[model samples]
Target chain A: MIKIKLLFAIFALATAFASSAAADMAIIVNPNNAVTKVSSDEVKRLYMGKTKSLDDGTRLIPIDYVDGSAIKQEFYDKVVGKPLDRIKVYWSRLTFSGHGRPPETLSDSARIKAWVAGNSDAIGYIDTTLLDGSVRAVLIVK
Target chain B: MSRWRLPLLLSTALVGGGATAAELKWDGFFTSTYSITNTKSTYRDIVHDDGSFDDSRFGLHVVSDIHPLWRLEAQLFAAGYEDNYATRLDWGFASFHLSERLNLKFGKLKYPNNLVSEYYDVGLAYPWIRPPHEYYSLEEPSASITYESFSGASAIINRRSGDWDLVAQPFFGEVELAESDANISKFIGIKLSASNDLTELQASVAQGRINAEGHELDDQTKRIASLGMHTEWGSLVNYLEYAVTTFSDSEEARTKAGYITLGYHFGHTMPHITYAGFDQESGWGQQSVTVGVKQMLNPSTALKLEMQRITPQLNPEAGAEMASGLFMDVPEKTRVNAFSIAIDVVF
Candidate 1:
């Protein structure tokens, strides 16, 4: 009976660690903005520069985290559904062709959240653990 | 002012004064390649028995957003194509956002002929060190209707339907072909494309009057049509394009070119193969097979190695005069092999 109890405790600990490791990401905008919800496809399109405006005709300024950030990689992998290398190539094509530009990158998630909170037209993604009333979460990326 | 002086001054001024009233962004790309072919004759003026670095090039792109409705963009480029790397203005344009779905651009614009025409010089954007010559070479003897850029205006229209984003571009322009002393006037074209997350389909049609000096192509009406598709299925990627050009009065100049490329990704490395063909109505033709691999060193840099085998088609009964195929100064029918190594980077 003691062996089974110990095994159960170990399994519970592993589950807790896994859940924390796979933390959720939140797509955030200024709390004053009218938008309350956004689809994954819309976020993808906005971040990719395929669309420049929101559904209600508000021009959007998408922001990104700096290169080599672990959260940046996770956001692209989970939300954008494209490998980071492919995204780089796609932006290269657009930038060189004068078609579009990628989002300007900030240093960290705190700055991204702060920027989103300050600008009504800005949108950014951050770890859900960093969420607060300063910004509104439009989409929760799993 | 010299050709290089204006863009340099403009760039300096813009960058220096970028702190106020406008959002300025700067980006650049570079490619350096060494290529050699097993032949005495030069192919594309760069590849021959003696290796050359003439394929290397660099470009700097700048974009200034002055307002919600106005933007300015320019690209300064330098290349080693027999000119000793002279800097020049590749394209400079102003874009006007008229509405949520429409934009107008005026200036020097990249030729909108094929799928890769706009970003062809940026090797990091594609899997090949060089795009297949059979379809991408503008100086190919059989079909030389395309130009690098035109001075004019273009409009972009956008729409969305279900999961696809649709774009339509209509443009009119005039261009001078420096290589052959040709002038294209009254040029008009339209390109339509639909794309989603994993696929894109494109079609375009262009018409122009061509006048080449001291050549048989004088005073000809040229019409070109092309179809292209680029798709990715998980780790598998495919690109296919077919184009045809018809000269109103020169039957022998009617040409068709096509290529299909298949590539599979293995982590950070991809190996690709392509089969390309170019043919004229008078039975002059060439076909090539290219095999290459691209390795991503990082997010913004790539290294590529490629080998190609080109076979020239000669038809004496069809009254074809030259067996040079795409190579220069070849007198007899023969196959040529080429090898190239390149590094591409963007920042």
Candidate 2:
């Protein structure tokens, strides 16, 4: 009986950690956004400023939480095909020439959620647990 | 002293008030490079001799969104491209987006002359610390050098369909040439560019004439076409470009040039091979081949090594009193083999 009880506790703890790790990342878009889904590749292009519009020609404006955020790094590795250093150099080259600007940066997930919720054209990443009726969750990054 | 005082005062105020004041966001970059070659040329003295950071640079940039549709930006760059100390204005522009497909820009613009012209201006932006100096030769090549930077208005248009993307741009501007008031008359040019997941192609044509001291030298015309392909299998990037130019004067002169490069990446290191040739109306032509290697130590840093064999060709003159003038008093042929090492960094 004790062995079974201990096994149950261990399983519960592992499940909790897994859930928290997945919930730590949430792909967010404005409430009015009609897009229901996004592929990992598309998300990468959008955040990198490579593609300016969605499939339906809806203009996209991307935002970021901060430079070194875990979600940001995850998004880059999954989509951007480059590490932080390469992204920095890429942005440095583009921004210095006035060709493009890096995405707007917020302090934390709360601010990211708030910005995406208020702007109809904005998209960002946030903690899934913090999402509510104010915004729409489009995708979940594993 | 006065310029330094302002920063000092601002820091004092921030410390005394203990106010975060919106948490100033910062972004910037810095780079250093070194080059070496055995080409017996005067321009060699101006570039890196070996593995040393002679042509170094550092820059800072910042931008703030004043509104949803508007933003303000500025950048300052300091480099040793020509000498030990020289600061220049890289870009200061105001852009007003008219629509999703169209936008208007007014300010100092980096003119699109060649494939790598804009990024090559900054050392750290490319795998090579110094662009092929023989091709992007700074001073002696009057036409290619002056077209690197300009001031004027530009329009950019882009459209995408499936896995294919298309972009087109046409601009009109006059470039600053030398200290003289010699301004290139209005130039109208257009570029057609297309890209898929693995391959990309671009072609451009521009025409204009130069007016120096009210002396019309000739009507200047330029056309360049290039194709680039990158495949996923080996992470290979290969490109080739051809440029033809014609100048009108009391006598008409034409020049033609082309370059091809194939690069493959192996984890962090990429090795490439290059072949290029160019010809001038002055009976001067050159052909060379190079083998090079580049490594990305990190995202913001890279190192490169290259060795090349260059041969300058001299054509024979008509009605000359020499035998096979092509192999005349030019010691039959002048061959130069050069090796170079470079480092690039961004912060």
Candidate 3:
């Protein structure tokens, strides 16, 4: 009975660690904004800076994590179907040609939430565990 | 020191309290290439050299969103093709958004054609040290029309449906190039591209009137068409392009060029192979095979090493001169080797 209990304990710990490693990401927008949910394609377009407005003509601002971050890599690899470097290369082609810029980057989740909460047009992402009353969740990436 | 201090103070004051502010974004890129070849003539953007940095170029770009619906952009570009650091305004444009899907731009726009034409100068975006010269070369006896820049008004249409995105642009512009004495008084072209998650397809058609005074035909018009496809699956990338240009004089004088490339990415390294060719009726005919490797230093920097074997295949039966194949001074049916290393960076 003691051995079985220890095995269960180890299994629980491993599950917890796995959950922590693969974080659940949530896309956040300003609470006052009318946007509630966005499809994956809409998110890709916004992040690529293809368009600045939402479906209802509300100007939307997309935020990004700084380079070489774990969550940023996960977001790009999982949601955008591209490596972070490849995405940067795409941006380089546009940015150097004076076409467009990537989204504004923030340092951490706290700062991101603060920025999103203050600006109605802004959007960002954070770990679902960091969810609070300040920003509204728009899309959840499982 | 005073000037720096004043500007710093003003920027701080503007961001701190000012209400009306322009959001400015600045970017820069540089590419330095050194190539060694046995030939004594120029090919594509590079010239005949033992080892020349003449292909090196530096650019600084500034984009300002002065208003939500209006934006201005400019690029200060410096390069030395044959001379020393010559600076020019590469592109400057202002765009006004009519709706979420359409916008109108006015200025000097990058001449758009195939998948890599507009971004051909941006080396870090592609897997090659340089795009295949026989297919993408702007100058000379390679093929037919040259897709460079012009002053124009452009309408850009952007649409997104499901997992695909489409961008179509049509423009009416005036193109003038005095170097080759090929003057284009009026130029009109349209380009349409669709991109899915990992695939992109593009097609373009252009019509132009040559402002010729002593050439083949004065005020004669010609047609150019191009089709391209690019796709990436996992580590493998494929690029294919085919173009044909029809002159006003005769259908036999029409030029054609095409190329295909396959590349595989492994970690920070990507190795690619390409085969391209160009045929012109006036005697110049060339084909090349290029093998290259690109090493990514980081997200914004890369090191590229490439080697190409180019053969100038001129048809003697057509009564063509060796000088028409201007890529090199080598004997006809001989292959010239080009080995190049380039470093590309973005900041």
Taking the tens digit of each residue's C-alpha lDDT, what string does model 1 give over B1-347?
Answer: 34566476656656665545576789999999999888776786777678999999999999988676878888988888837788778887789999868999997888775788888889999999988887888653322256457779999999999889899999999886644567899989999999988899999988888878676667788888889999988889999999898888888878899999999999889999999998988776789999999999988999999999889666433344433567665633388888999999999
lDDT, model 1, position A8: 100
Report residue A129 deviation for candidate 3 (angstroms): 2.8
How does chain B of model 1 score on TM-score? 0.92
Docking class of 1: high
Candidates in descending lDDT order? 1, 3, 2
What is each predicted model's overall lDDT from 0 to 1? 0.84, 0.61, 0.77
lDDT of 2 by residue, B234-276 (tens): 3676766676655644222355666777787676777888887
Candidate 3 residues A1-142, lDDT tens each? 9999999999999999889755889999999998898877678778888778666677788988888778889889878888888898889877865557899898888888899999998988889988899999988897
Fold similarity of candidate 3's chain A to the true chain A, as a TM-score: 0.87
Q: Which ten residues in a row have the lowest lDDT in candidate 3 chain A?
A: A50-59
Q: Name the candidate, 1 or 2, with the larger lDDT value.
A: 1
Give DockQ per model, in order.
0.81, 0.35, 0.67
Model 2, first chain, TM-score of 0.82
Better of 1 and 2 by TM-score: 1
TM-score of chain A of each: 0.89, 0.82, 0.87
TM-score of chain B of each: 0.92, 0.76, 0.87
Please give, for residues B74-95, the per-residue lDDT of candidate 3 as tens digits.
7667776734766656666778
Which one wins on DockQ? Answer: 1
